[model samples]
Target: MDRTYFVYMMASCRNGTLYVGMTNDLLRRAYEHREGLAPGFTAKYGLKLLVWFEQYETAHAAISAEKRIKRWRRRWKLELIEKLNPRWEDLYPGLVPGPA
Candidate 1:
């Protein structure tokens, strides 16, 4: 299988908190967030819905993008998501399949 890397943004819900992160395995990392598996800021802030994501060929690139996004203000982040995901929907459910 080909290795994939992702710089992703997760939101608590509509017009809610946002979290930025990077991972080599997008699916696994997304699942971790959704399941609240890791005890960290995301869990504490209830940021679990995958609102936006960008794929990269290398983990370094993904990490860089993640850092850039993290530095952005909340309003800027919201604008970014709104540009692609206007509804701010939980994109994770659609990515995996079955019931959301």
Candidate 2:
């Protein structure tokens, strides 16, 4: 079976700093930090909020996009998100498998 991949955006809080990464397991990865199971920049910087994520068919493609986005200026990244999510809301509230 093919594994699913995700290109995710995480924020410090509502509109704090943003971080982009690619993961094969979006839920588990997000949960890891939410539950403090993972450590590093995200956990250290308190950037556990899942603001946005996009599914990709292949990990390779997801990773490629992630690296490209990471190279983008902060202004560019914010503009990209604003175009899709004007409010900069926490997208996980709706995408996560739970109540709102």
Candidate 3:
């Protein structure tokens, strides 16, 4: 079965702590982070804002992108986020589906 993979960036706040992750289910994973269900760096630092994300057709490509971005300099990551979200707004609400 075909499945989608996502590379997403979460942050505590604008110019705050950042976290990179990959998941098959973006909403669920992001929710888990938001709820502090997965205790770790994100929980410790409160990185609940989804600053940026990209979808991939292949798992390999998604994994590669996530890995590469995780190693990037903080300034570069910030620039990437600003390109998609100038104000560093929480994108989770926008991603959620509207009522049918």
Candidate 4:
């Protein structure tokens, strides 16, 4: 089976603190953040809302994208998020698997 990777951004709120990361399982990672289970920066800053993400076929590409975004200016990061998620909604719900 082909594996998928993702570069994602999370925030404390609209126009608030931002966090960038990469993961193979977006849903699990988002859940960890939402539940305050992830350690370090995100948990400390309460950056639980999934504001933006992009999928990649390779982990290398996803990691590179995440590293690049992490170095971006705050303005550029905000602009990127707004471009895709204007309202800055928590995208966790949509990522969750539906009940069987």
Best by lDDT: 3
Better of 3 and 4 by TM-score: 3
For residues 17-88, write the lDDT of model 3, one tens digit per residue: 999999999999999899999799999999899989999999999999999999999999999999989999
Model 2 agreement with the true structure over 27-77: per-residue lDDT tens digits = 778887666677887888887777777789988899899999999998888
Model 1 per-residue lDDT tens digits across residues 1-100 = 6678998898889889888888887788899998899679889988889999989988788888889888888899888899999998888877786765
RMSD of 3: 0.7
TM-score winner: 3
lDDT of each: 0.86, 0.80, 0.95, 0.93
Winner on lDDT (2 vs 4): 4
* Model 2, backbone clash pairs (residues 3+ apart or across chains), number: 0
In model 4, where do residues sit more than 4 Å from their true spots? none
Which pairs clash in model 3? none
Q: After superposition, how far is residue 32 of candidate 2 from its true place, in Å?
A: 1.6
Give the C-alpha lDDT of model 4.
Answer: 0.93
**TM-scores, all models, native as reference:** 0.88, 0.84, 0.96, 0.95
Give one digit per residue, the lDDT tens place, for model 4 in 1-100.
Answer: 9999999998999999999999999999999998999989999999989989999999999989999998999999999999999998888889888998
RMSD (Cα, Å) for all candidates, in order, is 2.4, 2.2, 0.7, 0.9
Off by over 4 Å in 1: 97-100
Model 3 residue 16 lDDT score: 96
